[model samples]
Target chain A: MEYIFHITILISIYGILALAQNLVMGSAGLLTIAGAAFYGIGAYTAAILATAFGFNIFTTLIIAPIVAGLIALGIGISFARFRDDYFLLATLGFLMIFNTVVRNWENVTGGSFGIAGIPKPHIFSLTFDTPFSFLVLALIVLFIVIGICYFISRSSFGRVLNAIREDEDALKIFGYKTSTYKLMVFVIGAMLSSLGGVLLASYITFIDANLFTVNESILLWAMIILGGIAKNRGALLGALLLITIPEALRFFGFPNEIAGLMRQCIYGLLLVFLMLYRPKGILGQYKL
Target chain B: MKNILETKELIKSFGGVHAVDHLSVNIQEGQITGLVGPNGSGKTTLINLLSGFSLHDGGSVFFGGAERKKITPWENQIYNITRTFQQIKLFDQMSVLDNILVIITERNPFLALFERHSKYHISQAEDILKQVDLFEKRFHNAGELSYGQKKLLEIGRVLAMDTKIILFDEPFAGLFPEIIKKIENIIKALKQEGKTIVLVEHNMNIIRNLCDHLIVMDAGKLLAEGHPEKVLTERVVLEAYLGE
Candidate 1:
């Protein structure tokens, strides 16, 4: 039962991350690779506040997203001039810098040793201590993120984003400040990803630099691509599939020695097949 | 008639060559001004300059009798100046109606987040689609539209802007005759609404039929200007542009 809850909680967490990433990469057509960096910023913010400053989970939740959003604003403004591959490179560079900071900022982040013993979330007398309780919390946050993504997808602002993705210059000729729209969406995605980080930190009661690396960011991208781009249900479906597949592989009774490698091989093959047959994923409306 | 748009000694250069070199021109209000020139004769360059797609290296552009310092597409749109591209740019991923709605939708990003397209906006988009004869395909994706339909959608988007001055760059180059006639009617209707229009094209027949006043260019300078019939017969315009 605990194991099932654990898997469900992970799905919920990754579902939020996928939805956030979809808004930037799928909806807005920004090829960003720094999702893990923002996620890590949230984790570290919560971890440091809980461990060093003695702040609670709720406080960290609010502050962490704000911090990540501010950083995203700076990045969006500075990188506004870059397009296509250049934008991708700029975001990748930020991810590298963020990784370095978390690994070397010994005083605040605990460097490579990491921080642990994060208190589970609580409001008043209710504490999300057990896996079941935390699963409930994660599900609630996931639903909220889903609702936000849905609202954005239905609004006039969403239409503008679609226009931007298709032809930003043409949107500009229609009097849209394309740079401003890009910046706004970038900040919104970063802030939501930070919320996912907050949940991960408190749920596990520990966080380290390894949890938020370029590989992790790429995994988020893979989840979105496999499920569907620009589709909220696709994002959730992607997170669920990617999270459950490895665990399902365990039941196949492969030798423990080669199990991890075999799982990787199967994962790569699955993605390759999906790309070959369904270039837009299972339910994608747009192709990058 | 008052000049709705005027350029004074305008200069735009690429490396050592001037695309629009020290060229001065006037676009009169409520008049269809045709810009005709040979290839590499600064017609499109002048449109780019006027529409704020490209910046000038020297001289000034005066709109509504005010000397503009700097220009950007959105800023010009706010000043009631809009344009269409030669390549027929549209929001390909959006639906046909959405391509028009995106123009008429709210500009405030925050307010737009909560605001659904009002009934007025939907009706407005529908009217534009009806005008362009794409009303039946309103729900189809813009990218799925045929080339001629895409051109119509592009024009429909510009109409949604409801601007005072509209600059069209080669709007009829690849269009079918019926589509060209449709666009000709649209331009004539826009002039009837008291809008200023600057059309850049190579079709002499269309130019002679649609243009109220014609300005001819050669090598980035004004080669001739007058009624299309009189200017078409000018020896310099004939030799430099008409290839007579």
Candidate 2:
């Protein structure tokens, strides 16, 4: 039961990351890499608020998304001026900058060692310290996030984002401010990513700059690309499958070093082949 | 009549080559003005500058008698100024009905998140589709439409904007005669509604029939301007088109 709960919590956390990545890359058509930055920001925000200010975990959870959202909004505004590969490059720069800031800001973020002793959320006298209890919290948050994403996907705003992907020029002539819409999605996606970070920190009771590294950002993108770029089912499926791959391989009894190497090779092959053959991803609406 | 849009020495260049060089023009309200030029004559470049696609290097553009510089394509829609692309720009993945409905529906981001296409928005979309004779293909994906149909869908998309000034950049290109007639009627209806229409078309027959005033451009400069008959007959215009 504890093991099952652990898997559930991990899936829910990464599932949110994948969904947020989908909104920017899939919906808004902005190929950005600043996602991990926001995620880390949320984790650190929650950690600092809970530890230093002695705030309630629930309040920290709520405040963390807002802090991450402001950072995303600022970066999105500057990045909106660029397009194509340039925009992607700008976001990559932002991710690196965020990581560096988190690392060097030892006083606030606890530096490279990261903030530890993040207390679990409590309901009256009940503490959600165990994996089983955390799983319940994670699953509830997952449903709420998924519900919100599902609603947005079917809404008129979703159509605009899709339309932007189809033809931004067309959306503009149709009296839509495509850039503003893109920025909004960027911030929202960032907030969602950070919410995942908040849960991740709470679940593990620790977080560091390494947790939100650029490699993790790429991993989130890979999950979205593999699952299906634009579809909701795709995000969830991608998160589950990608997260379980290494564990599933563990049954072979290979050494950790060889397993890690094989995992990297598999990820590389999947990404390359997916791009070359199935650009639309497993469940994408549009073909690559 | 007061000029609705006027350009004062508007200039734009591409890699040191002047595209719209010292171009000064005025578009009066409620008139269909034709902008004609051979390839690279800066007809589209002028449109780009006016629509805020390309920034002007110098000069000012006054819309409704206010000086505004470097407007965004989306913000220009709020000023009741909208344009169609030379390449038909429709949401290809979306149905033709959605292509039009996305325009007329609430553009607010928050509202967009909560609201699906309301029945009223769909009805309005269908009305525009019917006007363009595309009601039968309303459910078809816009990309599946033929070149002519795509052009018409783009026109339908713009019509939903209900703008005061509509710029058609090469609207007649790649269109069949029947589609051309359909568009001509749509432009006519827009004109009848007292909307300012600026057309950059090569088809002289349509220009002669539809354009109340015409401006000829050649080599990024204004060649001539007047009624289509007068401007088409100008020796300089003839020379610009059919050079010795």
Candidate achieving the largest TM-score:
1
Candidate 1 residue runs with Cα over 4 Å from true position: A254-276
| TM-score of each prediction | 0.97, 0.94
Off by over 4 Å in 2: none
Question: Which one wins on DockQ?
Answer: 1
* lDDT for B231 (candidate 1): 94
DockQ of each: 0.79, 0.65
Expressed as tens digits, the lDDT of each residue in B33-147 for candidate 2 is 9999889999999998888877899989999999887777778767888888997777887788888878887788878888888788988999999988899999999989999
Q: Which candidate has the highest lDDT of all?
A: 1
True contacts kept of 2: 0.74
Residue-level lDDT for B117 in candidate 1? 92
